[model samples]
Target: MIIEIIGIFFLLLLSAFFSSSETAITRISDVKIYQWGESKNRKYIKAKELMNSRERVIGILLLGNNIVNILASALATSILIGLFGDKGIIYATLIMTTLIFIFSEVLPKTYAIRESEKLILYASPFIKIFIFILSPINFLVQNLVSSILNITNKETKNNDWKQNLRGAILLANNKGDVRKPDRIMLESILDLHEVKVSEIMTHRKNIEGINISENIDLIIDLALKSRFTRLPLWKDNADNIIGTLHVKDLLRARNTNTNLLINDIMQKPQFISENTSLSEQLNNFKKDTVQMAFVIDEYGDLQGLISLEDILEEIVGEIFDEFDKQIAGPEILSDKSVVVDGAMTIRDLNRSMDWKLPDEEASTIAGLVIDIAQKLPSINETIKIDKFHFTVLERQRTRITKINIKLIVID
Candidate 1:
């Protein structure tokens, strides 16, 4: 009886060890394991190998854990039966259930989760050996499970790479391993593929350009006074962008010849579709070595202008220069109303003011108002959208210039 009881205790401890090891190893992030593995850490290498075939690892652990647990319970029942007869069976079941639940499942799992990295390093070698020894059983069990799932038409979800990466970044941030700005930048870069050029580009009306028909002296003066390094040169109107004139080119022209024409100094402007993804546009900017590109609609009308700086700002937040005018995001009026530039992007406004104004159908404040109103709104015309009211304060021709927004107070 003593020997049988000792054997049962040994089996139960083995079951608990396997249970804890499984949880610890699987919980360690693959990225961290791979990093350690690359440095030739034997424990991390073994852990990585085990995780490489996760189905096999999990199958082996489950098989071994169950075998030991069942053997321990059987031995306990037999030992107790000899001592107390029929009543021993009932006592054995109750005692084994409580012991297994507390020691094997809850206590070990809690400890493993708290010290996952350290526990994984210690347990991986033993787990790997167990996996190798149980290869045949693991393979059979995995195949059976796969077949069962297939027959039931239940497919396992593949890991989402972006979501995993995002989770890892957020974890790092929460742990204070990554600073807030770095975390935001990393997340913003991930968003580049989803965002469009038109969503962030400076609208056509806001673009600073010189008319090609203007005098060379006036063009030079405009270029010198302008904060932008590159200015668009348009023919007839702002929409007909001919080329981009660099301030450096103008300076070179001034040194070489007093009679500098806009055509002589302007570089051919690169044009991109307004709907182009920011990621693709960024690649194009690098490949072409172009800083600025004219954004056009499907019908070839100028929609806006996008630059390398603009794409970069999407990742690194706004970049401002000494000469760059500081356009305030949104201004608060005396009557508790907020005044915003019509060109302000809906995304920016929502982020700055903590408003839930929709940006799906329109990109800018003006576009959203015009889209909802179904026509150009006259100055001082108030329109209610959701919980907010917007009044057009100023208009440049057909375009909205400034808007006053007020949130409806719920009494």
Candidate 2:
């Protein structure tokens, strides 16, 4: 009776070990396992192998756990039956079930989930040995399981890489491993493929350029006055952008001879469509060894300009240098009202103020107004959209310069 009781206890403990090991191994991340593998850690390498053949490991664990649990219950019943006769079976069932549920299932699993890394490291060797011993049974079980899944037409969907990456970033943030700004940056990088150059480009209206007709002295003066390193050189008008002139090239020319024409130093402008994805454009920038590109419409009309810095800013937030002018975003006038520049992109305003001003119809706040109003709004003309009021503060002919936005309360 003593030996039988000891054997029952051993089986129960083994059942708990299998249960906890299964839970811990499943919780360990593949990235951490891979890192350990790179360092040639034997336990992690074994863990990785088990993880790779997860179905087999899971099969072995379930088979071993169930077998031990059943044997423990049977042994306990036999011992109780010998002591208490017919009533011993009932007592044995009740006691064994309670013990297994609490000690074998809940307690071990809870600990395993809490300290998954350490549990995986310690449990891996035992798991590998069990896998080797149970290989034949595990293989048959896996085949049967696969056959059943195929018959039921149940297929497991692979996780989307983008969604996985985004989830990982959010998880890191929640764990306090990654700060909010860094999390946002990481998310932005994942979204680069979805973003387009037109969404972040400096609109043609805001572009500062030098006309090729201008003399070297005037061009030098324009370059000195402007904060930009690369300036577009147009032939007759801003619409006819011929090439991009770098300030460094201009300065180099001035040092050699004062009679340098814009054409002499201007590099050919690389033009990209408005619909080009930021990720693709970034690759193009690296492949072509160009820092700036002219964004164009379908008809080959110049829409705006996009630089490498603009694409990078999408991921790393704003990049400001000594030459960058402090262009402020929308100015908050009150709790409900604010003044915003006409050229301010709708996406920028929405992001800064946490507003849901739509950008699908138009890119900029001014353009959105024009798009919704179906015509150019006059100064002081107030347009109501939902609970928000848009009052044009200034207008440049068809273009809006400044506008006051008021969020109306629906009392």
Candidate 3:
């Protein structure tokens, strides 16, 4: 009877250890584990090994925990039945239930929630040993489970790798292991497949292009003077882009040979729809081994141009070359108002200003204004939307050229 009492109490401690190990193992993030692994620490290496065999580790711990708990319950029942006859059975059941629930389950898990890193590192080796000891049993159990699942013709896979990685990156960012720019770049990579080329491609009006009818000398000079490496070539109209004239190719054609024909040196233009995604365009660029592509509408009219660099810039931010000139930025006035080019994208403004101006319905600042106003705004016309105070400063025919924004503060 004395041995039984002692045995049940010891078994409860073992139950508590298993419960804490389970909680701590699950709570510790992969980011923390990798960070630890960087130190070449044996404990974390073992931790990584345990993480790899988590299914087996969990199975072994659960099996061991249940075995101890059941043994404890039996000893407790035997002791109480000997001490107080039939009613002791009822008392033993109640006492053990309360004791196990509080001391073994709730207390250990709550402590683990706070000390997960330390507890997991400490228990990792023991868990690994237990996993090794129970591998054969775990395999049999896994096969049994699979056989049962096979009856329903079901299959399961861990497709949340992206989600898990995203979470880990975010967690690292929160822990100050990752900087803001790097975090943004990391998240942007996962988002590339979802973003459309039309969202970031240079608009047709902004493209540097020349008519193929121009003199070869003039074309060569424009190619030299222009900042862009690849210039779109038009045959009759600006919208009818025929080919992309590479400045390098043009220079080579001039230096290597006397006859400098633009048509002969120009690369065939690759046309893609405005609705094409950045991921699809990137794959196309890789497959075709092309640097630039011309974006077109449903009617085949040239909408804009997108380059491989543009898609890359979507992840890493703007890429500027030697010839690239600094574009005019927002002019911040004394009254806390900013005047900016209406052609500026809402995404760029939001990023630069750290404002939450919605970019859902429109792409550009001017477009946003037009969307909210439901009309082409006249110069000096002011409108209020949410916390934004929009005042059109400049208008060029049909489009708003420049606008002023004053964010209203709420007390």
Candidate 4:
């Protein structure tokens, strides 16, 4: 009878350890639960239920205390030889404690920590039973906790969804689920609204398009020799741009000789303001069935050209295709100042140079210089605005008028 009682005590202690181990392991966040109520997202629900019904859960835990109590009492009644059995009882107690420590406390908890998801799944039914069995205790606990909370003036705080979402993003980032460029691109896409069209458009001076009245042969000659597949066709100068013509359109034209006029092959160009957002313009492009748009100033002067590819480059960095012939990014000159390609987007320049160029109407460094100078900036000409100065470096029909920009130091 004595040996049997000591063994029962050991079993009860083991059960308690197993139960606690399972609960602790399952609560760790690294084990993701797919439902809305699982993980950090459902922390509030778990917190609320626990806080509100504290007494019930505590009572249930206390009920489990029978394991410890029955085990201790069994040792007292058995191995304990009535009055003089204190030493025997102590021996029995130590044996039971050691067994519980190894089997119930250490092993189960270790398994739980390592296999939390599996443990949680297995424990779910048991947890539900406990919740039901302890419902009355839960109600009492809830009222008591509410009353105490009222006294303390504590209100429940919900789960941090943004924090959780960030955690998920971080996890993906850590596991190589997304590459650095791809992540940056995703973020850049999200920041599209913060970007204006001027940052990504080709500057006006560098724009090469044939006039609508120009001979069809010249247009065809330029189109054929030219690297670009699409060319803006204007009525006069760029300011009067009528539409755009695709190389394919030229190929498909009924009359393909020098006598062919631009109006004969031109398709309408999408017109958008310099301040339009990239994401919005992308949608506009899709809706309008056009790949490119003419960016215009408030006065309707042609500022530059913006393409779907250009906007996409903002997010994904450089994209080189068969039609991509223009050099982009900045080239720091022999001097401290830089010589950026005219085709480089203002957004890229601003990010690279940390320049505070006004974002209102222009998209290229050249356009910004032109806007500020109000005329083509000449070599050795120094223009100062606030802390910055601009000196013209080089200029051409297709080249960026290289400029040396210096920031003045304030004493």
Model 4 stretches with alpha carbons more than 4 Å out: 1-116, 130-179, 189-194, 254-261, 273-275, 297-302, 321-411
Better of 1 and 3 by TM-score: 1
- Writing each residue's lDDT as its tens digit, candidate 3 over 38-57 gives 76788877787777766667
Q: List, in order, the clash count of every candidate structure.
A: 0, 0, 0, 10
Candidates' RMSD to native: 3.6, 4.0, 5.7, 9.8
TM values, all candidates: 0.84, 0.81, 0.72, 0.53
Residue pairs with colliding backbones in model 2 are: none
Could you give the candidate ranking by TM-score, starting with the highest? 1, 2, 3, 4
Candidate 4 lDDT score at position 201: 75
Which candidate model has the greater TM-score, 1 or 2? 1
lDDT of the candidates, in the order given: 0.87, 0.86, 0.85, 0.67
Give the clash total for candidate 3. 0
- Write the number of the candidate with greater TM-score, choosing between 2 and 4: 2
Q: After superposition, how far is residue 117 of candidate 2 from its true place, in Å?
A: 2.6
Clashing pairs in 1: none
What's the CA RMSD of model 3 in angstroms? 5.7
